[model samples]
Target chain A: MPPSGIRRRPGGRSARVRATVLAAVDALLAEVGDEGLTLDAVAERSGVHRTTLYRRWGSVPMLLVDLLDAGTEDDWRAPDTGSLEGDLVAINREVHAALTAEPSVTAAVVAASFRSPEAGEALRRFWEDRYERCAAVVHRAVERGEVPPGTDPRRLLVAATGPLYHQRILLGGPLTREEADAHARAARAAAASGLL
Target chain B: MPPSGIRRRPGGRSARVRATVLAAVDALLAEVGDEGLTLDAVAERSGVHRTTLYRRWGSVPMLLVDLLDAGTEDDWRAPDTGSLEGDLVAINREVHAALTAEPSVTAAVVAASFRSPEAGEALRRFWEDRYERCAAVVHRAVERGEVPPGTDPRRLLVAATGPLYHQRILLGGPLTREEADAHARAARAAAASGLL
Candidate 1:
């Protein structure tokens, strides 16, 4: 391979650098949260020189934006639970687990978005992709005649998942998996009645 | 009047000082969005010395906490529209308007909560009081036979309004008043079916 081509190889040094850096970012967010997160800390933890961090990411918010941008967007897919209720419960369970997990980076990333518009845009992209992937759950229900034809996937999804977020993230309360399923049931009932 | 009685009078000098300072805090939050807010700015804008602000509030988050605590908690009450659907629509309209307002202090305050544990506690207090006030809407509906007996008011209220916060604050999207009512309708339907 030519000398220049070696730099572009899959799993090359460049890819490793990014993976290592983002992993450190994730760990820092989980531990220190958005308030404690800084590019200096990222460099110190990752052993990547501060100059490279400054030249590339430039700021903590940008680093956070890139961290979310590098998430498993394509690798994840909605569960096939064979029924609308089951699918919604499964989705809510995943969401609740993510939001309630110990030292969740998700909470930090979300908080950081408020501090920066670029990070907020990155968050929008993250949610939009997530909604796109989860749209499959609603489409499956439609095909199975579980919900009304043209029962909006977005509205149904927002209804199903919004409460868990409200209670866990916004309200800062204890949220059990059972409570999340209750919200799923409510969403299911609403969709069945053609309200959503 | 006794000297002590004069100092304790309603709307006295101390109350005026607090009111003026909190108003400045609100203005700064709306103008600067949490990032630009500082105690020094509050001092300068409110004509209160930084020493008093430091001795009292101590930090930006605490100032935010006090600002929310000074809201119209007693003056505001839920609307009595004689039906659950009507009451819910009215409540959602108010929430949508507050959230969608240009340079909304609400967005700034909600964002500030993430930066401090005290601010987060204050936010929980804010929502709890709001929920308590809105519970009247559901109770009246129960009395009017518009919904089932023993329908939980908190869950119903969360269902009605969580979508707007999820869309506008968390996901960073354009939320129209119509979409808010749709959520309210879903909550109304869910409550009627005993899902909430």
Candidate 2:
């Protein structure tokens, strides 16, 4: 039923099937909310069989988590912008671009993560990894005497992302490219002064 | 029908009824969640009839907004601690106490706020009002030569609250009294350095 010669393997085509189902689930979530997303709809959209979808993910939350797993956080490796200010501006721009690209999807994922513990755990890992990556960049800056060593890398990572999300949800701002750059400049100044 | 003598009039008695309904919604949201809450449950729990609940609030989100309205940010009057450091520390403690006292409620409200415009508007009003109030304190400090006049009040407010929420959600910290004091110190230092 799904695009020709794709028979189920006896050994368990589980990995491939999971990816397909997750893609479908992402599509469904983007179109319909958590309340409207159903296993049948996902199967229909993803081209995966209903049995396959159910066999892999037992519930909506579980399916959502799988989709979340498929998408990772943006790479946090520090930019070599030659200055702390330039590095922060690059990071902030990336964040605003990501959120703006998928506003509704981002909002739903955020809401889902808050409501489900499984989603939260996965989301936490994603954030931790991102922060660690970003922290490495800040570390280099400290070594170069750009910032004080006592700077909390974790707080800096938060400062980079916090304003974007805060303004997106709270202020209904455009989250435009220009604003992201401004945030980066501000955060870099804040951090360099050892204030953050 | 609601507890025998509880009148359901719109002006005086209805105000009491509104309060009772809001309390019920708060408890329900904290216990069950947004999806699980219903008019029937509110009626049964609040002892108000179904017809009355429907007549007052048109939908679940609307009801949630009303509950949020009842809990509006009223503690915005800035305190004069004669210095930025003292003022920030005192304000941080107040915020920490509020969030820690009702983490679940705050989480639910935040999640719902992300999805609903009404909730988002309510949240914006709440945070903006608080920020403006806190900014007034910073302004007073600048007036007294405690901090530089060029300091951005908006940025200062975000940095102050950022860590409190970060610890609560990401690090899972206690957001205790001592920690609030620490936050105040860091935020004030940042403010003084013109980073905030």
Candidate 3:
């Protein structure tokens, strides 16, 4: 038996529980969508106690908010490849990959965004955090004289990823790697022209 | 009861029923989202018989599909002001208006797109039809020597509208009229630079 009475390392068990619960959230979202998800279902699926889940997450919307916050934290580091185009391509490709790889989860989160104010707040924070994190790519590009000064990084990033999102979510179309590359290229061109 | 027993004019009552059913769909979608909407609920709200709804729409997804088709048909006429920039701006503004004015319905339809293949097909058809209908703006621009020959109309339109959709749907951000104008200007700039 693993030291049943011993004090656990600070945050170790808590982190593990968070990971397990979030993973269950992901699984449930992927399998049944946000509409069918519930705290009890999450508890049963994660094998975490219902009381703990209730105390921690409180509600389905809050759980989804936490899940989005957790999900975006891992994969959104800015890439620096010595060129603006390179950095942008890297960012666009990562976005396309994430959106495509787990479309169901993306859909679930997006649906939740419309249905729940908490989820919307979480999503907004996620995008804002992501934008702030990646703003360095544009700063680097400006220093390298690859683009003019005052080129807005957030606007450029939005231009780069907007088409892909539109195609995937609104148009219900496929977002190919080639399309991602083209979007990045177009954004770069627009930036080079000082449009961004 | 003036002419109750007489043969009704072709598509008169049928059109009214469709309009009523679709309006009920919109209301339900706005009130409870797609997850909570059902044909029986729509029947109760629409005052159309459930069996009639089943016979006509067959399912909620089909009803949503029809609703989308009908909605787009009325709102998506191509605006031609004899200038590419003007037309594009008009298109962008209309899109922004529609997406913003009824975000809940938009979100519900988008959510349905992810959950149901039938809805996806309907949405795809809706977009394709809209694109086809709006291709004239770019064509007219080319004819007027405003844009380069062979500018892909669909590509230009996508670039024009993608950021708006991205902001409204994915980022859950507000799309201002100024932003819509800016998007149109940027798309025009990109097109002028042979980037589109």
State fnat for each of the candidate structures. 0.59, 0.18, 0.47
Per-candidate TM-scores read 0.87, 0.75, 0.79
lDDT of 1 by residue, B5-65 (tens): 5568845867778889998998887787788898889999999999999998899899988
Candidate 3: tens digits of C-alpha lDDT, residues A102-139: 53777678768766779988988887888888899989
DockQ agreement of candidate 1 with the native complex: 0.64
Candidate 1 lDDT over residue span A89-128, tens digit each: 9999999888987777778788888768898889889888
CAPRI docking class of candidate 1: medium
Q: Candidate 2's residue-wise lDDT over B1-196, tens digit each?
A: 3544454443667778888999898888778766667899999889989888888897777787887666563344767778878777778777677667653676667667755779877766666666777788878888987778887776666656655666665434456676556556665665665554
The TM-scores of chain A alone, one per candidate, are 0.91, 0.80, 0.87
Q: Predictions ranked by lDDT, top down? A: 1, 3, 2
Candidates ranked by DockQ: 1, 3, 2
- iRMSD (Å) of candidate 2? 3.9
Off by over 4 Å in 3: A1-6, A23-55, A58-63, A72-76, A102-104, A112-117, B1-10, B20-63, B72-76, B102-108, B111-120, B142-150
Which should have the higher DockQ, number 2 or number 3? 3
DockQ of each: 0.64, 0.29, 0.41
Would you list the clashing residue pairs of candidate 3? none
